[model samples]
Target: MKTEAQFENADVNMARRSFLHYAGAGMAALSVLSAASCKKDHSKPQMTTGIDIGATGDLAILNYAYALEQLEAAFYINVAAHMYTGASDDEIALLTDIRDHEVAHREFFKAALGTHAIQALTPNFSSINFSSRASVLGAAKAFEDTGVSAYNGAGYLLKSADYLLLAGKIVSVEARHASYIRDLISPSSFADSTVIDSNGMDKPQSIAQVLAIANGYLTTKVSAINYGYKAY
Candidate 1:
C-alpha cells in the first residue's frame, strides 16, 4: 500500500516504529497539548466551528482524528451529565469510561498540534434521546463503531508507518469501546454483520460520508478543510 504521510512531504515516520507500542498506550495521557491558547477563533461557514482541513498529511490526519474525538468526548460527557433514564449503574460506569477516553484523545491531538490544532466542535444531538438509555447506548455504539472504521479506513492513507501504527493502536481501543456499548444494547450485537463486511473486515466510510451520516444527529456541520480532506 502506498501510504501517504499526514503532512506535505514529511518523512515516512519510520523513526518511531521501535517505540510505537509505547506511544499508543501513552496516547491517552498526553498532556501539555497545544490547546493552551488555540480555540475556536471565529464562526465558520458551517454551523459547526472548526478549522480548515488543509490537505492530506500526518498533521492533517491528526486534526481529523482530533475533530472526531472532540465530537465523541463532547457527546459522552454530555450523556454523563444528563444521563439517560433506565441506565444501569454498570452502563453509567462504562459510558463514563468512554467519556474519559475521548477526553484523553481530544487532548492528545491538542497537545500534539500545538498552534495547528483545530477548534472545539459543537455536536447536533437532536436525533438522540438523551432520556432513553437504550437510545443513547445504541447511538453511542454507532458512533464508536463508526469511529473505529473511520480510523481503519484512513490508516492506509497515512504513509508514516508510525502514524499508521498509531492509528491502528487507537482504533483497536475504539473498537473495544464500540463492542462494550453494543453488548449493552443487546447481547451478541457487538460483532454483527451490519458493521462487518463479508470478508469479516470492518466497514469504513469516507470522512465526508461519515459526516453526512452524522449530520442528521448533530446540530452543527463540522468541516474538514483544516485537515485538508478534499471531497472525494
Candidate 2:
C-alpha cells in the first residue's frame, strides 16, 4: 500500500507544513523583538507637541503608520480592558493577541522614527459601544481592514528599501488580522469580494481617504502636509 508516489506526496506535504510553522514562528519572534527593544530612549529628545505627519519623505510615511498603530493599539487595549459581554474564551485570546501585535507594531514605528514620531494621540471611541460584541467586532473589522489598505496604498511612497521591507512584514500581519476579524464577523467572508477585487488583490486606499475614516475615532487631528513625493 506504500507506493513511491504516495510517499513523495506525503513528504512534500510535510515539508510545506513545516515551512509554514517555521514562518509563523519567525513572525512571532520578530514581534517579540520589536516589543523588547522598546526601551527608554533617554538620549533622544521627545516632541512636547504633536507634529503633522506629513512632508515628502520616508519619515512622513512612517509617522502615518505610527498614527494608525496607535489608534489600533488603543482600541484593542480598551477592548481587552472591557471585555464585551458574551465574548467566548477564544474571542478573548484572539483579541489579546491582536492587542499585543498592535502594541509591537506601534513600538516598532516609534523606535524607528525616534524623535520624529508624533505625540501619543487621544482616541475618541465615543461611537463604539465596547460592551456589545457587535459594536466591538464591527470596529475591529473596520480598523484592521483600513490598516491593511493603508499600508498597501502607502507602500509605493516609501523610498527606502528597509522601510518598505518593514512595512511589508507589518502589512502581512495586518492582512492576517483583517482576515481573521472578517471571518469572526461572518464565517466565509474573510476573502470575499468586499475586500478582494476582481483582480484578486486587496483594495488600497489613499492617505486622505484613510485619514478621513480614521479621524472619526481620533480626537487629535492627523495631517499630511506634503506627501506627494516622487518614489525613489
Candidate 3:
C-alpha cells in the first residue's frame, strides 16, 4: 500500500548508506597505507663541515675521543634496553647509571664539536650476544677499560687544557665503572693482570690502534678528517 514515491525514497536512503560504508572503509585503508609508508623511511644523521679545527692534531684527538664516546654510549644504551641474563638488581641500577654517563659524554662531544661534529654512529653489537650475562658483562668490562685507556693515551695528545680536563673527568668515572663490573664478574679482575700494566699505570692505546680494534664493531667507517685527526 506504500506509494511508489516513498518506495523510491527508501531505495535512495539505502544507496547513501552503502556509499558511506564504502567511503569509511576506504578511509581506514588509506590510513594504514600512510603509516606503512612512513615506516619505510631510513633517513639518518647528516654531516656538516668546513669549520677549521686545525690539522687533525688537537682537534683530531678530540674527534677521536668523541667517536669512542659515541660507541660506548650506543653499547650501554643497548645493554640497558635488552638487559642480559642473571643481571642483579644492583648491577642493573649501576649499569643504567653508566649508560646515562656515556650518553652525557657523547652529547658533550657533539656540542663541543659544533659544526665539525661527526654524524650519529650506529653500533654493531652482533659480536656480543646480548641474551647472555657473560657476554654482556664481558663486553662491558672491555668497553669501560678501553675507555679508560683511551682517555689516558689521548690525554697527552690534547693541546687544549679544556679538553684534557674533560677527558680526566670522564675517564675517572669510567674507571670506577670498570672496577665495579670487574668485581661483579670475579673478585679481583678489576686490578688484575689483564688491564693494569707492569708499571701499575693503565695500559693505553693510540688513536689509530684503538680505532683498529673498535672499528670492527661498527657498520660504518668514521672519518676523523674534519675534526683535525690524521688517519696515518
**Largest TM-score belongs to which candidate?**
2
Alpha-carbon RMSD to native, per candidate: 11.2, 12.8, 20.4
Off by over 4 Å in 2: 1-51, 228-232
Task: Name the Cα RMSD for model 3.
Answer: 20.4
Among all windows of ten consecutive residues in candidate 1, which has the lowest summed lDDT?
3-12
Give a tens-digit lDDT track for model 1, residues 1-232. Answer: 2222221012112223323344563343232222422343533433225345444355567777877887887787678777888788887787767766776666666655656676666678877888887778878987898798789767777656656766787789899998888888788988899888999989987777666555555554556644444332
Clashes of 2: 0
- The clash count of every prediction, one per candidate, is 20, 0, 4
TM-score of predicted structure 3: 0.72
TM-score of each: 0.74, 0.77, 0.72
Instruction: Point out where model 3 deviates above 4 Å.
Output: 1-54, 223-232
**Which digits, one per residue and each the tens of the lDDT, describe model 2 over residues 1-232?**
4443453344335434444343344334444434544553434333322346755367678889999999998898788778899999999998878876787777666655666678998889999999999999999999999999999999998866666777899899999999989899999999999888999999998887888788888888676645542211
Q: Is candidate 1 or candidate 3 better by lDDT?
A: 3
Q: Can you write out model 3's per-residue Cα lDDT over 109-135, one digit (the tens) per residue?
A: 665555556567667989999889889
Local distance difference test, each candidate: 0.67, 0.77, 0.68
Lowest lDDT 10-residue stretch of candidate 2: 42-51
- Candidate 1 lDDT at 55 equals 46
Model 1, TM vs. native: 0.74
The segments of candidate 1 whose C-alpha lies over 4 angstroms from its true place after superposition are 1-50, 217-220, 225-232
